[model samples]
Target: MDKNKEKRPSFVKRFLRQTPHAITMLFGIIVLVSVLTYILPAGSYDRVLLNGRNVVVPNSYKIITSTPIDFLGLFKAIPLGFKSAADIIFVVFAGAIMFAFMEKSKAVENSVGTLLKKMGFGRKHLLIVIFTFIYGFLGVAVGYENNIAMVPIAAVLSLALGGDLILAAGISVGAMTIGFGLSPINPYTVGTGHKIAELAMFSGYGLRSVLCFIALSSMAYYNVRYFKKITKNPEKSLGKGLDEEGISLSKPIQEYSVTANNWLVLSIFLMGLAVIIYGVFNLNWYLIELSAVFLIIALLCGIVSRMGATLMSETVLKAVSLAAPGAFMVGFATTIKVLMEMGNIGDTISYNLALLLQDMSLYTSAISMAVSQSVINFFIPSGSGQALATLPVMLPLGETLGLTRQTTILAFQIGDGISNLVNPTLGGLIAMLAMCRVPLDRWLRFIFPMVLVLLLMSCVALIVAVATGYN
Candidate 1:
């Protein structure tokens, strides 16, 4: 026997060495939820059509026939989840392809480089503020999930601007998290929550806007401080390994010259954004419509860049391949909800939780509602889905405790939105981190402080909503 021969690692050791892939984790959650159905009783709330949306009727819960998912049914739910989440999956694909095409044209690189150069080195903090606002606005307008496609580009820009990957995540994902948490008009959370509570759409915009400002301002300050620290001593960065991963721009900053064509392409992009805003605010467009808008913009960008048909097709294909795994993860995440519903235990969980909260004071109940929603968000990350599942039980419970429906919605918004930043089960955050090659553990450490600040602010905001009779 050769004494120097290397011994192979055991299978368990090798498996433990590997980070749990996002899809594998989500599938495990689905299986766990399906098993819970057998142990938990089955119940449901009566639903009614309100403003063309299905909303649960208050106090309508009743124990129903059990429908525990069998092994075969659990297997079937994989495809069913993909089908239900198709719209968002395509949105991810379209957004990735659009940005990929822009990268191919060197449009984004040129714009970012030129903007940084113009801002000069001394004013770099201003750039952080600007990007943070833009990302936050996107979150408020659409959603954080829809903005996952932008993470890589933001990473490159941050690196080029003398910042690090964490700074990039802070400005892009962090700002978006703040916006998603406090957005006055985000249809996914605010709109859905309001509809479920039978309140007028966006009726509490004044207070929400104030909260958004405070959250974003604080987040921007945190990002700036971190950026300054990392720029001074790169070795201290939490995401130090991410820099070695080479997620930066392919060419040097000097190579990316801002040409007239670049401005034209950018102008067209802004116009498309305007069109999307109108479509969302007036036309009431959603994931499908937003995807179409992005697809059209991608084509226009290709035309503006004067790329040949084959070149455009190849670029899109490359992007689609790059984004395929993330899109699949989105579908996989949706499976948790599908399994819970199939097991017929979603309402049962809600029913028990409501009963637990029934005896608490209004303040305690509101706080509990927010905290419980945060926990539930781990399993059902989709804002609209969570609202549909929990609001019926929460709304009635709030009313019984002399709480306003608006306060209930506020609790839902805070709980559902803030948890996205930290929840490992959230596909969008996982996808963004994957794009930047940032590990989940490292991100958790870097972001935990901000999470606490945001949660504290959220509690204060909920209290204000209750005291002011926010309805």
Candidate 2:
């Protein structure tokens, strides 16, 4: 036992020594993207205001003067990223502290544990399905950033279910991203693409829904398989360092019991979720409103749990402090997007990608559209941001290449969605990983196979979409 404990720590030590911190990785990517702005020719497209949002004018591309990020600008891009992504950054910190305080009353554990029991432990795979699929479509209705608060709860549940942080992230934020990436409602990608393509809103959801289901299934299977592997053998866990505690969150079976207080806290949480959902759909709430809801939930949990002022203050501080690293990384990851915009290379890259799809067979052109979009997704990770930058150019370009506007949008979703699984530039993804305490490298390694599977599915979907004359 002594030897085994010593060996585990050494392995953890080695892992930490070797693993690149997410912030460091993102910082390097920021530098790399900044450099590309210097190397790539700068370009811009004329934009026209439509319904208060600027719509990219198709075929209005022109090469502009190159104004790449200089040395000072490189550092400036980070704070710019922080300002731009402040809403999401706030969500990350808010979600963490809220969950931390809720868990302090042991309320979250008892409540979720009770549900797991009702789920019959035998049906834990169903839990993965519900978390991935249901959560995914919820992402469709409300963007994934709104669902950020659920990740820590899912991570705790995943740990209780004999899975690691990667699995937690996979089912929660990971599945939700599928919805955001492929949302037929055009909450971001589809919606913006439709407006740009001049297609009727909700025009091609049949094919998009099919894509969403298949994509969700692929992710669900991957998450379930991972859960089974880790449960049967704890060594299969991919998290390193202190995160290796896959099953430690669970108490001994006999010791587990939910109290009335647990029920109260759970009710508060559920009601909070319901309110968030209502506000999002009805009031059109975003980051600030969502963060306020979570903060309110945390304070209510503190009140119901009857902690003193001093204890409450300390708890809130601790949760926020614990959340600091992930929050910082969230802003850090957005730096790449900031640097790209600052360097004025976003439209230039889009113009060049449109040029690549100029002459190809219809089916091949559709897939190529997706391929090119996937490449651009690396720099501009936001679905709407990417759509605004590239689709105006690609939409008209698609017309010349005999691809439908709907088909082009389909390719955009495929390319954007799959790459989001691994895009280092996305603040939402970085925030999820940070919340789960899953290192960036570990997640990339864990999700690579699934991403490859999803990519294959995306390619096949794009080809089929074109062949059927989908519009």
Candidate 3:
């Protein structure tokens, strides 16, 4: 053997061996998306504002000879996305700060102990079920991005229950995604689609409720199965990939107890969440209102915890610093949308997808619509955004194909929703994963199979919606 021979690592070998950082992977996606812009011609429909949202006009698409993104625009997408997502970023930051104070109070942990004791569930499976339903209900009745603040609390609960971080994400992110995807009365997706389909808002609740139950049950069961697997073999724990150190369950110093201070903190936090839900549903509260609620929750928690104003300020600032990475990850994910917008290919994609359904059978068209909605979601990730952009084209297409309006909307919402679970372009899920220190690759590995399952369920539900003429 030659002593001078060096085992130099090949570039391909090293690249395949190393996990790309989240931002690196996201940028690669952005690059691929940007390249597609030049390949697809720029096209769009005129839009009219109804109730403050710009809904696309059907049959209004026209090709535009727009310039493809220059090299400068590639880097500029980051700042553009930040501008577009400013409100979202602020609320997420506020939520993080609020949760930081709540973490300091240790109220969430103590409250969980009290909750477990009160619920009389000695087994952990029930807790998993409850979490899936609780967060799933929030996703059903409320919104997705707003619930991100609760990720840490969920993580702690999962840890305490002897589960890994992935279980926490599955119960929270996976369940919420499913709930919102299939929910009958979900204000954002179903509500928006109904408006576009010209059906009374939330009129077809019966079928959606049944579909939602099936999806939620599947999510809960998956979380329980995952929890059992990890707990059975700690070696299989996905939490091993987490970057943050010192993440483990707290051992009760003495038999668990909640003090007066703990109770006050818990009340304040719960009340704040209640206010958010009510505000979102009734008062149409959004980013600013949500941020204000977080501030109130934090100040009250700090006061009850007897932390001085200065201490609270420092704690929150420290928290903001810790969460800064997650926030930036959000901006990176948002950049994907920003790039698509920069090139004006979103409508082109939608138009082409709509064309695919023209020659298909009714049921085939329905399933094809669901698949198209999933594709559309990659460009415009928001539930309501997809409704505004795609539903106009889809509803007309469905009408032509002898499909009911509800069937069309069902396919739109489900496809748009199930895709969000693994869609790296969704800022909220990406940010939440960053907060939990879960790697994107591992999350996809853990959740992609479930996404496929949910997508299958979604397709079947669409078929049912068509067969029953649900409307």
TM-score of each: 0.84, 0.91, 0.91
In model 3, the worst 10-residue window by lDDT is 244-253
lDDT of 3 by residue, 1-471 (tens): 754456666564344346566777888988888788788899889999988999999999999987588788898988998888777777768877888888788787777766666665467899899888998997887777667767777777777777888888888878777777777888788888877777898988887888889889988998998888887898977677664332343655245578889989988988998998899778978878988999999999998899988888888888888777777777778998989888999999999999989999988999988888888898899888888988888888899999988888888877888888878888778777755657676787678667778778777877888888877
Q: Model 1: residues >4 Å from true position, as ranges? A: 1-24, 141-153, 192-201, 204-206, 232-247, 250-256, 423-446, 467-471
Better of 1 and 2 by TM-score: 2
Model 1, span 302-401: residue lDDT tens = 9989999999999888778766766776677777768877888877776787788888987888888899898878767778878887887788778889
| lDDT for each candidate structure | 0.78, 0.81, 0.81
Which stretches in model 2 have alpha-carbon errors above 4 Å?
1-20, 243-250
Which scores better on TM-score, 1 or 3?
A: 3
Please give me the total number of clashing residue pairs in predicted model 3. Answer: 0
- The TM-score of predicted model 3 comes to 0.91
Once all C-alphas are superposed, what RMSD does model 3 give against the true structure?
5.4
Residue pairs clashing, model 1: none
